[model samples]
Target: MHGEPADEGQYTVVAKNPVDKVQASAKVSVCTKSKVDKLADVAVNIGENARIQCQYSGIPISTIIWYKDGKLIPTNDQRFVITQETPTLSVLTINNTDMDDKGVYSVKLTNTTGDVEGKVNLTVKPIKPAITRDLDTSYTGTKGEDLILSIAGTDNPYPTCQWVKNNTELTPTTDPRIQFKENKKTNEYFLIIKNATQNHMEEYQAQLINVSGLIKSKKNKITIQKQPTFIKKLQTIRVNQTDTGKMECQIDALPQTRVYF
Candidate 1:
């Protein structure tokens, strides 16, 4: 192209490289590599979310894939779902996971240039359940006494409570031996034992189950001991020095309960 230059106008010529200039080789050949991409100290909890990320240093960002303990993690449990606007390749999600879900995860960036791998450890923390009770321990009640069992605890969503007796689970049966009551106002649970019996006097526990797992309260036992009755008996007894009748005392219990001074 040619251009006319005015007296005050400045003009210059520019040169372009040959069409095959890009095809020229420096000495012989060269190749690029996929950049390293990895996350660090990743931590999460059960019923929580976690995201692993890696950025590419190469001219072009590499295609990355997340792996859990050397196993390729799918977008949908093995499906490849690409997310837009992010440099991430794959994401692994564990719903209501356990201690077993923890492991080392690697980010593998594979592309036409080469392959790069970066590692990170996934830490899934254990969830500790919170517990609440109406009372710590109770005194032995009379026969046919109604005992309430109420338990509350904290968890991700909520905590589940169950009454365990001698390591055996008990369900509401038609035998009418036990009754279950839930206090909505207090958000507590109760196990009512109607007409307490010696058989009901055994080791019992309130177990709490949450997303993490099952946890038991301190071992508790129900003692069915009854109180002794006091009686004032009138007896004419002769005193050696006074030579007069003095009052006497006697206490008795139907079940032969023990008397403590």
Candidate 2:
């Protein structure tokens, strides 16, 4: 016999002969397979809690399970909390989410009739940018040589990097001698100065900014070293046997220089 909602009731079947009659009664039940009705993706910041909810429609739900990236979520894990507020609602909470917690989360609902599954994507955003590798406090380069300042770090959603020299921002378009470069995969940034000169010697810093926040590197000084050069040649003078004569010469150099006769 076909099963329907209206057929869910007690019934009796009788077999009667000329003088004898027999009857048996039974109850019928109607079952419906579960199906996911609503589910949504969730995004949360690092160190924050993430909540994923699933809404389903069905009858006689027998079991509910949660999974991450196709692996069953362990109930013993303290970071994961699973709850069913109602027969049709299921919730999963992840406490203190980090980069590893970001993945595809799914819910499986089972009933006497059939089982249904639903999934949601979890995204964990990183906090403020941090400098894993910092620039040196001081850098020295020879004049007319190439110099490169580099910094490495981690950041979410990527970040805009800027080079600051003596309080002035450095850009490729504004300064032809300077070039800025970044490697997204490595999370590294670079400031390149071609044919380094005395003008490039100054305090430098790197500023990183994104939606989360801004971070700046420590102040670094770039010194350009130059070889000593004679500004004035020695002068020759004639003097008598008892007469006194003087000879003088001028020299210029970076970091100052000592003169000897």
User: Which predicted model would earn the best TM-score?
Assistant: 2
List candidate 2 stretches off by more than 4 Å.
1-10, 15-18, 22-27, 32-43, 46-57, 60-123, 229-252, 255-261
Against the hidden reference, what TM-scores do the models get?
0.48, 0.58
lDDT of 2 by residue, 35-65 (tens): 8888899999987899998888776664778
Evaluate model 1: give its TM-score.
0.48
Clashes of 2: 0
Residue 124 in candidate 2, Cα distance off native in Å: 3.9
Model 1 bad stretches (over 4 Å) = 1-31, 77-84, 87-100, 132-148, 155-195, 198-261
The CA lDDT of each predicted structure is 0.62, 0.87
Measured on C-alpha atoms, candidate 2 has an lDDT of: 0.87
Worst 10 residues of 1 by lDDT: 1-10
lDDT of 1 at 250: 69
